[model samples]
Target chain A: MARKILRGIPVSAGISIGKAYFVNRQKERRIPRETIPHHLVAIETQRLRNAVEEVRQGFMDARARVPEELKEHGAIIDSHLMICQDPKLVESAAKNIEERAITAEWALERSINAIGKAFSAIDDPYIRERMQDVRVVGDKIMQALIGTPKPVDLPAGRRVLMAHDLTPADAIELELSKIMSFATAEGGKTSHTGILARSLQIPAIVGVEDLEDSIRDGDLVIIDALKGLIFIDPSEDELAHYGDRKYQFEDYQKAIVKQCHLPAETVDGYRLEVCANIELAEELVQVKDNGGEGVGLYRTEYAFFNKSNMPDEEKLYEEYATLAEQLAPQKVILRTLDVGADKLLDEQAMLDEANPALGLRGIRFCLRYQNVFRMQLRAMLRASVHGNVAIMFPMISGLKELRQARFVLNSVKSELDAEGVAYNPDIPVGIMIELPSAVMIADTLAREVDFFSIGTNDLIQYSLGIDRTNKHVSYLYQPLHPAIVRSIKFVIDAAHKEGIEASVCGEVASDPYCVPILMGMRVDGISIAPQAIPGIKRVIRQIDMEECIELLGDVLTHATVSRINTKVRKRIFKRFPEELSFFASLIEQDDITEP
Target chain B: MEPSGENNSLEVVVCVENELGLHARPAGKVAQLAQSFQADIALCVADQRADAKSILDILSLAAPQGTEICIKASGCDASEALEQIGQLFHDKFEGDT
Candidate 1:
C-alpha cells in the first residue's frame, strides 16, 4: 500500500514517477517580529530596498528569457514587475519600516494585509482577484528578506514539480527543462499550469487537494495523470506495476503516432472515416498532424462570442473561406451558431429563463433571430466555393425547424445569386441528431438532409433526463446504457435506410471501449478531438468487426446499464489491455459507482 | 471630459476598447507611460479615482471595455501626457485582442 494517495483533475495525459520538488510550498512561515533599534532603522530600510531591487532584476531577467511561443506570459511578468515597484506596495512598506522601526518582513506583511483589506472592499471580482498577484509578489520579497531566496533553481536532474499555486512569474523563472511533471494544489481544468504542462508534453494534475502537505521535496512520487492519481512512497509492488505501465504508455504513444495517418480500418477490412471536431480554424494543422481525414464538426460559436459586437458577414466569410481553402478537398462540416443555455449572448441574457437547456437554444435561437441566422447562412454559402464545405445545423427537434433553417439558407442562396456571388450550390446539408425527438423521427429527417452526425453527449443528457454537470444526478449519465445503445443504432439504421451517412461526434466516439460498439453499429465515421485521434484509430486498427458485432449482440441482451457495462468492459479490456490502461473510458467510470 | 483653461491642466475621455478590458497588460502599459512624465495624473471611472502611475491603482478601477474613463493630468507636460496615454487606449495597448 502507498503511504498516501491524492486525486485531482488531470489536464494532460501520461504516467511519470520522480522525486517531488516544490518551488513554492504554501506553508505559512513564522515571521520574527522584532522592534529594531533607532540606530538600525536606516540599515533595515536599506535591506528592504536591496531585496526589492533583487526581485525586480529577477523579473527583468525572466522577461528577457520569455520564449517566442510563450510571449503571452511575458505580459503577465510585466504586470508583476510593475506591482513589485509600485509605490502603493513598496513605498508603503518602507514607510512602515521607518515609522515603526520594525523588521522588514513584518513591515511587508502589514502592507500586504492593508492592501488585501482595501481590495476586499472593491465589488469587481476581477479586480478582487488581483490580490493574489499582490501576494505572489509579496511572497518573493519575503523570501529575499529571509535570506533563503529562490529555491526555484533545482540542483541537477529531472523531478516532479509541486506548488501551492504556480504564478506566471514562477513558471517563467523556473528552469522548465529539468521539470518532468507537475502537480499543483490550486487551479481548475483550464488553469495556466495545465496549459504549460500540455505544451511541454509533460504529465500534469491540478486542483490536487493536500498536494503540498502529503509529499515532501525529495519523496518519490508517481503522477498517474491518466487517472489523475498521485501515489507517494508507494510499496515495491506498486512501483514495479507503475514502472511497466509508464514504459508501455510511452511505447503506445510512439506506436500510435507512427500509425496515426493510416486509415482507421478494422482487421477484418471494415473502414471508418475518422475526422476531427474543432472550434477554431487554426486547429486544422492539429487535425492534419493527428491524421484526421477532415473536419467533422466545426463549432461556429467561438467567433460570435468574446467580443463586444457581433462578427460581420465579411469577417465570417473570410474565416470560413480560409479554413476551407487550407483543408482543401477534405470535407469541413460547419455547424451553424448554437448559443444560449450555458453560453449566452448579451441580448439572450435579458430573457433569463429558469431552465435554459429546455429553452431557446441552437436552431430555436437561430430561427428566432433571422438576421443573425441569414448572415451565417450567407457566409457558409460564400465559403462553400473554396473547398469541400458542408453546413450542419445543431439541436433540430423536428421536420418543421429543419425546413425553416433550409428556407433561410435558400433565401440567402437566391440573394447571393442575384448579387452574382460564386458559391457551391450543392453544399452538403446535415443536422445533429441529439434531441430525443429527432432520434425517434430520424428516418423522416434523414430523407431531407445529406448526412447525420450523432451528438452522443447531448443525446445521452436529454434522453436520460439528467444534466451531467449536476453532481446529484450525474451518476445516471450512462453512455453504454441499453437505451443509449439502442437510440444510436436506431439513428444509424434510419440514416442508412434513407441512403445517408451517419457519424458519431462526441465523447462517446473518443472512448476506446465505446468506439468498438459504435463501429459495430456500422457508424460511417467518428469525429473526436485531435489528441484522441491517435489512440482511437489505433484501437480501430487492432480490433475485428466480427468480435465487435458479437459484443454488441451480447450488450443488446442485457436489460440494465450495469450488465451492459460489465459485458462490454470485460470484452473490450481483455482485447485491448494496453489501450485501456492509458485512455480514460466512459464505460469504465460506471464500475466505481455502480453496485 | 473637457480640458481646463489653464495650460497645465488637461483631461480626455477615452473608452476601454480592448476585448478583455483594462486588465493587467493595458494597466501596466498605462502606469509605465505615466511614470515617464512629471504630471500628477489620475484615472476616474465615474466617482472612483486611481493614481495613473501605479499599476495596482489602475487595475483596482476594473474598467471593462466600452466604459468611459476620464484621464486627468496637471503638470508642465500634462497635455502631452494626456495625448500619449489616450493614444494607448485607442491603440488597444498595441497587443493581443
Candidate 2:
C-alpha cells in the first residue's frame, strides 16, 4: 500500500508520476527570533532593504515578461510590486530591526502580522482578500532574507510542483517546462490555477487538505488528478496500475481528437449541433480546432472586467466585429454583460448585497444600467452586419423582464436606423432559460425570442437552492435530480411546441451520462468548454438514439436522483466502459447504497 | 523667511473617481508620486489617516469609489504635493482606463 492517499477537488484531468517539489508551504517556518546586539542593528536593517530590493526586482522581471493579452496578470504583479516596496511593510520592518534589535526575517514576520490584524477588521471581503497579496510579498522578502531558493530556481529535472496557493504572479514566474503536474492547498473549480493547468494540458488538483504535511520535497509521488488523489511513496503494484492508467488516458485523448471533426450523429443517424462556450476572442482558435460548429455562448463580460471604466461602444464594436469577422460563416451567440454574484464587477462589488445571487445581475443589471447595456447592444448590432451574430440575454425570470430587454434592443435598433447605420434588422435575439421561472414560462418566452438556451448550471442552483461551490451542501447539487431533469425536459418540449430550437449549455451538456438523456429529450444543440468537445462528441457518435430514448425512459421513472444516477451509470458504464474510464461524470453514486 | 506664494501646509478634498476605488494599482501610483515629494503627506478618509507614501496604509483605509479623501501635506513643498496628488484622483490615476 502507498504510505498515504490525499483527496482534493480535481480541476484539470490527467496523471503523472514524479518527485514532489514545494514552491511554498502554508506551515510557519521556525524563524530565528533572537535579539541582535546593538552593534548589529545597522547591518540587519541593510539586510532587510536588500531583501526587499531583490523581491521587487523579481516582480519587475515577471511583469516585463507578461504578454500583452494577459494584462490582468501584469496588473496583479504591479500590485505585488507596490506591496513589496510599501513603506508600511519595509520601513516598519526596518524600524523593528533597529529598535528591537531583531533579525530581518523576524522583523518582517512582525510587520506582516500587524498588517494582517488591520485587514481582519475590514468589512469588505474584496479588500480583506488583498491581505493575501501582502502575505505573498512578505513571504518572498523572507525567502530572500533566509537565502531560500525561489520557484524559478527549481532543482534539475521534471517534478510535481506543490504550493500553499498560486498567486497570478507565482503562476507567471514558474518555468512550465520543468513541471509535470501541480497541486495546491487552495482554489476551486473556477480558480485561475485550474484555468492555467487546463490551458497547459497538464494534470492539477486544488484545495488539497493536508497536501503540505503529507509529502516532503523530493518524495516520489503519483498525481492522479483524474480522481483528485495523491499517492505519496506508492508501492510497486500501485505504480504499475497508475502507469497503465496514464497510458490509456493519453491514448483515449488522441483517439477522441482524431474523430472530433466528425458530425455528432448517433448510429441511427440522429444529429445534434455541438458548439463551444468561450469568454475571450483569443479562444476562437481552440473552438475551431476542437471542431465546434460555432460559438454557442460568447461571454461578453471579459471586456467589462479589470478596467477603470466600462469598455466604450467603439472598443466593444471592434472586439465583437473581429470575432464575428473571424467566425464569419459560423454563428456566434453573444451573451450580454452577466455580472454580479460570483463574478463581480468593480461597481457591483460596492453594492455589498446580503444576497447577490438573487440580487441585481444579468439582464437585471443591464436594465438598471441602461448606458452600459445600450453601448453593448449598439456594438453587437453593428457587429451583426459583419457575420453570423445572435444576441442572448441571461437570467430572464419572466415576460416582463424579457419584454423590458427587448424594448431596449428595439430602441437601439431604431436609433441605428435613424442614424442610417447598417445592422442586421432581423438578427436573432434569444433568452437563456436559466431561471426556474423561465423554464416554467418557456412556451410564453419562445414566442418572443429566436431560440432557447437552457443554462442548467444556474437552473440546478436556483431550483435546488444549493450552492455547489459550498462544500457542506455540494452533495445536494445533484444535476440528475427529478425536478432538474423535468425542468430541462419541460423547457425543450416547450421550445419545440413553439417551433423553436432549444440547446443546453453548462456542465450537464458536457457529461457523458447526462448528454444521452438530453438527446432523448431531443435538445437541438449543446455548448461546452472547447477542451471537453472531442470526448463528448465521441460519446454522441458511439451511441444509438434508440438506446438514448430507452435510458431516458428508465431515468424518468426512477423518482429519486440516486436511483436515476445508479440506473444511468450502470447502463452508460456498460456500453462505454473505455470512454467512461476517461471522463468524469456529474452523476456520482454518492448516495447509492447498493450496486 | 517663506516666499509669499509658497505655503507650508495644505489640505484638499478629493473623491475616488476610479470604478475600482483606491485598489492596489491606484494606491501604488499615489505612494510612488508621494515619495517623490519631500512633504509629510497623509490621506484622511473618515476618522482614519494613512500615509500617502505607504501603499499598505492607503489600502488599509479601504476607501471605495466615490468616497471623499482629504489629502494633507506639511513641508517646504506641501502646496505642490496637494495639487499634484489631488490631480491624480481627478485623472483616475493615469493609464487606468
Candidate 3:
C-alpha cells in the first residue's frame, strides 16, 4: 500500500515508530452529574466528604511514589492535598449538594466554578492562577467519585501519544521511557508543551488537526518529526526505508554518546570544552556518557520552583554537594535561580511588570531578596568543598547589579567563614551576557567576572526585542540576525581581552548552524543539551578554526537576518551536505509556511 | 457553625514582595500558614476576598506583586494570626524578590 503522510509543525526533532495511544481529554471518563432526590442529598454530601479524604490520601501516596530526585516537588502535592482539606472549599461544595439536591460531581464542579468566577472577577493575575488549583482539586475529587485511575494509562511497551493537547505539568508527569513521542492535534512551535518537549529532547509534531479522527489507538505509525511527516500504516518498502533511517539515527546517537569520552577539539587542534546543562543531578550520567567535561549551567531554580515551601539550607546543599561530588575536579557552574520569566512565581509578585521577559527578573529579583540569595550562595560555597564549583548570575544588565550580587556572595562567604564551614575560598563567579546592556558594557563587566556565558537565546530575544515565546514574533527571533552574531562576538572578544573564558549556552549551542558561527567567533566553550553534545562536537571536529572564523567573517558583514541565514545555510549545504537534517530542525517550519 | 474560637478581629494591609505575585508557591504558603491559626483568616485584594486558609481561595484573590492586601483574622488567635501572616508578606513569603 502507498504510504499516507500527514504533516504538522515539527516542534521537536527526531523519528519514531510506534502504535498510537489516542487520548482526547474531552472524551475521557468523567463523573456523570445527576441531581440527587432531596432525601438522597444527605448521602450525596457524605459521598463528597469521603471522596475528598480519599483523593487527598491518593495525593499523599502519589507523592511517596515520586522518585527521590524529584521529591522536592512533593510540596506541590502537599498543597494539592491542602486544597482537598480546605473546609471552605469542601463546605461550599457540600452546600451545593444539600441546597440544590445535586450529584456530588455537579456540586463540586459548581463550587469550583463559583470560586473560579470570584477569582476571575478580581484583576489580580495571582488570584486568577488559583482557578487552576480548584480545577486540579476538582479533577482529583472527580477521579475519586468516579472510581477512575490517574489519566494516561501507559502501555507496557513504547507507544506514541496522540493527544488533542498536553500541558507542561501533564507532560512532566508522563512516563518518558514508555512514550516514544508526541503527535498533538493542537499547539504551535512555542507552546509550553513544545518547550517541554524540546527540553526533554522528545520528538513531537504539534498542530496536526483531525489527528484523532484520522488515527485510533493501536494504529501503527512512523513519526518523522525531522520532516514533519507521520507515515500512517506505511508500506513495506516505506517501513523498511524508515527502519533503516531509524537505525542510522540510533547509530548516530551512539556515535555522539561515544564522542563524549573523546576530547572536543577542532581540526586545527583548538580544544573546546563541551559541557552539559542539566536540571537534575541524575542527568550526570548523560553528562559523563556524552563526554561533557563539567556542568556548564545547572538551573538551580528547579529545587525552589518545584516545592510549595522553599527548600531549606540542608536540602539545597545535598543537591549541590551531590552535583559537585559526582562531577569532581570538573567544574560545575550553577546559575543561581533564573526564576522571573516562565518560572512560576506567586501572583502578588507577578504584578508591576506587564511584560515578564523584560521585567524585574533574574539578578534584579535575587538582589531584592538578599537573604534567599545569600542562602543559595552559602549552599554553593558549602558544596564547593566536595568539588570544583562556580557561580553564574543570569540576566545581569549592569556593573551595579553585578557588584550588588558580589556583595551578597561576600556576605555569605563571611558568614560561612565565621561558622567555620570548610568551603572553597576561591570559587569563581561568572555573569551571563544575555541582555543588550551586558553586551555593550561587556569590557567593563568582563573585568569583574571570571567568565561570560552568552545566553544566545535571551540575547537574541532582548537584542531583537522579540518575544521568543510569542508565535507571531517568533519568526523574527532568529539566531542568525546580524546584530545577534555581532553582539555575541563582541562579548567573546571582551571576555578574551579580559583574560577570562567565554562560552555560548542556549538554543545556539545545540543548533548545527550556530555552532560553526560561535566556534568561528572564538568562544572558549559550549554547553548544550546532553543529547546534542556529539552532533555539535562532531561538527566542531570536522572544521578547522581558521575556516570557521573565515566563514563567520563572511556572515557578520551581511546586513539582514535572511541574508546571513541564506549565506550560512548555503555554506553548510555546500560543505557538509551529510548533516543537512541537523540544520533542518531549526529552519523547517519557516520553509513549508513561507513561499 | 464554624469552630473559630474567642471572637476578636485583627486586620493589616501588607504588600506582596515575591515576584510572580501571589502565584502558586506563595499562595500555598499562605494556605499552609493560615491552617495553623485558630482564627478565621480572610485575604482581600481589590475588594475581592478569599479565605486565607484555602490555597484555592487565596490564589483566587489574585493580588499582583506590590498589591496591598488586607489580611483580616477573627476569633481567639486573631492578633497572633495576623502578625504571622503580615510577617510572611514582609519576608515576601520567604520567596526571592
Candidate 3's residue-wise lDDT over A1-595, tens digit each? 4345677767776889888885555636434445567989888888999999888888889988988899778877877888888876799999889888888877887788787777778776645665676788888788788676566567688889888777665676678778889888877655556656766777898877668668756778988877777878878887787788878777767766675577878888988999988887877887777778898999887787556788888999999999999998898999987877666556316575777777768988788777778888888899999999999999999999999999888888888889889998888999999999999999999999999998887888788887765545667768887788889899899999999999998778877877888888888999887767777788888888898888898997889877787888788767667665533445435675310
What fraction of the reference structure's interface contacts does model 2 contain? Answer: 0.67
lDDT of 2 by residue, A497-534 (tens): 99999999877898899999999999999998888899
Alpha carbon RMSD to native, model 3: 16.6
CAPRI class of candidate 2: acceptable
Per-model TM-score on C-alpha atoms: 0.62, 0.68, 0.67
Q: Residue A148: error of model 1 in Å?
A: 26
Q: Output the better candidate (1/2) by TM-score.
A: 2
State each candidate's clash count: 0, 0, 22
lDDT of 3 at A171: 73
**What DockQ do you compute for every candidate structure?**
0.44, 0.45, 0.37
> Pairs clashing in candidate 2?
none
User: Interface Cα RMSD for all candidates?
Assistant: 1.3, 1.1, 2.1
A194-231: candidate 1 lDDT, tens digit per residue: 54465456888877888866877678999988877899
Model 1 spans > 4 angstroms off: A1-4, A9-12, A16-223, A230-247, A306-308, A471-473, A590-595, B1-97
CA-based DockQ, model 2: 0.45
